[model samples]
Target chain A: MNRKRSVWFLTLFSLVAVVTVFYVSDRPSPFDGIQLFSDDTLDEVGLVETSSTNEESFVSKSNAFEEMRMEVTEKRSQLRDQLTTKVGSNEFTAEQKDEAYNQIEELVKIDSTEAMLELIIKSLGYDDALVRIEESDVFIDVVSNEQSTKKASEIIYQVKREWPEAYNVEVSFDGQ
Target chain B: MIGILVVAEGANDKRIQNSLIKTLSSVLQISPHRIVIEEMELEDK
Candidate 1:
């Protein structure tokens, strides 16, 4: 009768252990809150992300003019730095130094000329203006209501009167 | 001379008294008598 009691006790202990293991394994994981969140909350998160993206896009689009100017300025700055370094270093001869200095002066003159032209365009009743002069090209961008071939021709004539270099003049109108 | 000789841009526009020209003159903040606003004519090629 003692042997029979020992066997019954061992069987009862194993059954209890197996039941406890199954109970723990069948429970929901701690990270199951994904299902607990409402659909409204997820939609709100998506809307916030979308709105922020739109705001960034608008800012970038509106700053196109400024971005162009900044790029030009940055390029000029780098070129000027290189020229200045060339002038100060002994690797360049006197003639080379003089040439670099003249290039620097020419860059200054180009900046002033573009600025003056832009001012004149503004004085001409344009809302805003930008003038960019490359070696063989002239770019004139104006904010105005009228964008006509006649107006373009007149702008080219006016620019040629001032600069008079055989430049390929291109005129752009921004009605915004 | 204390005169402001201004040239309007992009050819001459024939307006009925040119309200824009008058507006330009008014905004200059100068004596009306000392302002000369002229619209540049496109030269015949």
Candidate 2:
């Protein structure tokens, strides 16, 4: 009778264990919310990804635009240098250069010879501007103080002798 | 000696009735009363 009771108890315990295992496995488990993303959430994630991609593309395009601008500026500078060099080398006739320069000068609005001379002197840093107008020929004297007197006189003499149209350079220490 | 009296850049423009005097004096080679220098006034740049 004791052995039969022990067998009955073991069978009951095994059956309870099997039933618990099957119930736990078959029933829906509690979700930790990790894998519970809805379709709307998925769509939001997709939109975020797309926005990031677009931002990246925008950055790339901005960079490309900057590169193109730099290239264009460089090309323009190169062309200006080439043209200035050609004009200086007498590739263009005096009249032709003068006419072209006058057109550009008018468009850009350079009125005074002094300003033009200053620009010419400044441009000597990079390249010379083929002087279209003879400053000394047009002006009798360059107004200069004691400091710039010598330079002014030198330019005057040079221009007076260089251009046949200019007979003399009347230089004065004062701008009268 | 009729010379044109002109103004200086930094100084005021002094127009002399007898311009030849100032012109000759400024030129220094000729007598002031003998030469004439035309006076042209351009605005300061």
Candidate 3:
């Protein structure tokens, strides 16, 4: 009788444990809720900030694209400065200086091209467009608030016409 | 070769999707399969 009782107790315990595991796994996590709430709050804050500005708000319409272009320009300037320093340094070999110069030149070219492409995209009615050139590939991110594939194709056609030697040009839209 | 990804609020709209694909194909001279469209909620600032 004792053995039978022990068996029944073990069965009940196992069942409870399995049920607990399933229940825990099925329940939504509190962290997920917190994250979602925080994201919503941030979005609200952004909206408020944009709305508060009357005059500057017009420029802020393409804030993302402007920020991206600024960042690229800053990076290009830094790279150029570094290349100049390296080339003038007597510690580095001629070959090293040449390589550094070549790399920096290539980077500057890409940066300039990206900036130009972004300007073209903006002129094509995608004011919030970003262009990034990596190696031979070009990536375009256009705000899709009023963007269409037709506008995207127009940008692509312009890129091809201007830079036919580019390896791959990829365009993506960023909604946020 | 250009790969296009369009993120729009109404990405599920059939008209937008069809027009985007058709435009990309004609302009890029590539198959419609090459252009990818994704939908996301974007907050306008």
Candidate 4:
């Protein structure tokens, strides 16, 4: 009877270990978690030449903003799916699961707010805009040839008005 | 804890950076040090 108990215990332990390994391997890296920008590789691209034609620059800026928006949307969706899985999985402790859900919720909220702000900016006559909300800070990028301080101020005002809780708001044009 | 990175299309401009920092600091009611503004050029794909 004692020998049979030890055998069963060892088998269960091994099964648990194998399952744990599989779970860990299948999970995405926490470092690769949620980001306002999905691809850090985009930062590696060199700056556009100042000598480039206005139209060409405008088109390029618009494209970049669009790509960034798409990335943000994709990442938000991915995070939501991960959150659902984490919540449903029995691997994490109750506290750990709650923390994971909260983090994902925060990311999704920020992403949604940023997307809404970007649309508002675009409707206000901006060609294209990218908005990233990290914690309490809000960053905005607008497609324009010149640095429009007036427009930037207006954006800041709009954001503050819409989301009074946002701690910081920074606005920049596409070109210097 | 808030960092804002803005990718622009042309040469870096100090004026824009300063203005952004100042505006963000004032509006957010946080010290300028708390707000980071990175201005990069947009890469064409």
Candidate that scores best on TM-score: 1
Expressed as tens digits, the lDDT of each residue in A1-176 for candidate 2 is 99999999999999999999999889766884755676665766743334575555444443443343334333433444445565577677888777665654532332244345535433423121222333323442222224366665665555444454554444333221
Worst 10 residues of 4 chain B by lDDT: B6-15
Question: Which residue pairs does candidate 4 place in steric collision?
Answer: A174-B8, A174-B9
CAPRI classification of candidate 3: incorrect
- Interface RMSD (Å) of candidate 2: 26.0
Worst 10 residues of 4 chain A by lDDT: A66-75
lDDT of 4 by residue, A1-176 (tens): 99999999999999999999988889766675455355664676667766557777676676666556545554565566677789999999999899988988787677677768878988988877888887778888888667767878988998987777789888878672
Give me the runs in candidate 4 sitting further than 4 Å from their true place: A1-53, B1-45
TM-score of chain A of each: 0.62, 0.30, 0.56, 0.60
Quick one: ranking by DockQ, best first? 4, 3, 1, 2
TM-scores, one per candidate: 0.50, 0.26, 0.47, 0.50
At residue B45, candidate 4 shows an lDDT of: 42
**Ten-residue segment with the worst summed lDDT in candidate 2 chain A?**
A124-133
Query: On residues A52-132, what C-alpha lDDT tens digit does candidate 3 reach at each position?
Result: 454344445456455455455545655666787899999999999999989888876776777687778778765466777
For model 1, name the residue pairs that clash: none
DockQ of candidate 1 relative to the true structure: 0.01
Residue A163 deviation, candidate 1, in Å? 1.5
Every candidate's DockQ is 0.01, 0.01, 0.02, 0.05
- Model 1 per-residue lDDT tens digits across residues A2-94: 999999999999999999998989987777677659786677675433467555544443356554654565467568768889999999999
